[model samples]
Target chain A: MQTLSFQFSAGQPAQGRALVGCVGSGDLEVMLEPGTSGTLAIEVVTSVNGSDARWQQLFQRMFSEQQMPALNISIHDFGATPGVVRLRLEQAMEALADD
Target chain B: MNDRLDQTRQQHYQAHDLLWGFAPEHLPLNAPAWVVEALQVEPPVVVRRAQGTAGTIAVGVRGKTRDQRFACWMPRSAVSHSVQPEQLIEPGLAQAHRDWPLFKALALLAEPLDQSGLRWGVTGSLGFQLASGIEVIHPASDLDLLLRTPQPISREQAKAWLELIAQAPARVDVQLQCPAGAVALAEWATSRSQVLLKTQVEPLLVDDPWAVEHVAP
Candidate 1:
């Protein structure tokens, strides 16, 4: 029962190059759409089944460093490692489109 | 149940039976002693107290508030119970067992949804136990429910849920009045529309499609 949510606003994209990305072993999915809401909503539900504090720390740091807009992101993890989560989140953020 | 009670408690049980009569379903098998303890107080100021002697008390309060109204019979033979402390019916607590079958239906129908972050609460008139200019014209009258959820619901799903609730077996009868069905939920979503009253039989839906607003900010 762990949840991670964050909001971000990335400036308009000049061209389409998959605003978000996906990074997982044998299972990766990303949703890219025009941003209507000012802030992007990111939700991640993972089955990594570990300490909640670690998840939150990694998620917050990733979100703060990236600071991308025009995207809402989510990730469902099944034992996906930190490197994998970071990769998937970046892909998702990049795939997003500007409205 | 009566066969197990002591003589004194038995007399009290008989007294209650004489006053409230018998409802096998409604009778609390183990009447929470707290209810009796609470009743010993001013018993939450009632909204509409019964007028005549021995009239069953029907009090109304809001779900968010603690105010309780008691509708009880006051016969000349016995003195009204004195108030007690440690049990204060704060304002806004709604109780509606005496007037409408809606509350009864809610009590019977509500079951927690799994892992959906959805919770159901009763607000407005039924939740408040006050008439929102609505009348209970039938013994099978339906009451309104406030459905708070994280995911968007399709019109088909909403209707199906209503049908499920209507078909459930219980002490009270229920009829569902979904505003989305009347006006078309998809069409409403396209226009960013909120629910509006169409007629006496219909209820409205407001801000239901979006996930952000669905969950509390």
Candidate 2:
């Protein structure tokens, strides 16, 4: 059960689609697209299946912690741990923050 | 033993000071001060008056047998000896060792992407203070790695690397994420892999977007 989620807010769409990448064996890729929706959404795809419950717990924890606004978040997970997921999620937020 | 402990403690303090010096305000919230002290260690080395090698110490880890211990050292006393602390002995070193398997694993499995084009910088434990805070010498913890790859990362590569490292050793944990894409990746993975992988991962924001640094008045 290795999943992550987050969101951000912006007055308008970002300059470009925020892209999060990985290549460290076992990990998946990520692409975040902004939408007309006021709130941002997050998605994750991982190789390790059958742990949605755990993913929900982790996502809920992070979402409440960050209190982010509106944005679409996406993830491709191979088998990453909570820590790696955390870092990657943070990286994505930071990339969006830059926008 | 006391001297060894003191030296180890000094190394610990040195790492702490260095980390603070680099990023004073922004510290790893969960990481404790003692944890850093525990992992900061001196490679086993003892300088001898008799040897008179300009006070350069002979460092070596002890072994089950004296013969085995001696074998780990250089053939010649002055031939430059380096001691590798056992995994259990130090937390920081242990983390480095723990990460070795996965780092190497990624190197072996990853589709060859020429990093030469990328403005790649492998910074962190490998630098000075020589501490990654993953050793058992004091309080052991997880491994931390920062990879600022050349170009922006692709979604496919991110998930692949994450899964690969996570499957390495159960007790050990590995994280490979872009400094910028952490948050977005978290959101994206939620819907796609929400069932298993995404649930376990937690991503966040890095690179200090605020630029907290400023000049003194």
lDDT, candidate 2, A32-87, per-residue tens: 67654456566775545565776677777787665455556677775555666666
Best by lDDT: 2
| Span of ten consecutive residues with least summed lDDT in model 1 chain B | B13-22
Interface DockQ of each model: 0.01, 0.14
CA lDDT of each prediction against the hidden true structure: 0.36, 0.37
Error of 1 at B89 (Å): 67
List model 1 lDDT by residue over B1-217, tens digit each.
Answer: 3333332232231111112121222224554433444433222222221122222332222112111222333322232331211111122333434444654455455553223244444332343233221232344534434344334567566555656655544232211123222222223333222322111112223344342221110
Native contacts present in candidate 1, fraction? 0.00
Query: Per-residue lDDT for B4-57 in model 2, tens only?
Result: 554343222210012211121222455445323432352222111011122122
Query: Candidate 2: which stretches are off by over 4 Å?
Result: A1-15, A26-28, B1-217
Writing each residue's lDDT as its tens digit, candidate 1 over A6-96 gives 5556655323334322222112334545454456565666533344677678766876776555555555543344554565555444333
Question: Lowest-lDDT window of 10 residues in candidate 2 chain B?
Answer: B13-22
By summed lDDT, the worst window of 10 consecutive residues in model 2 chain A runs over A6-15
Measured against the true structure, the TM-scores of the candidates, in listed sequence, are 0.24, 0.32
RMSD of each: 20.3, 16.2
lDDT of 1: 0.36
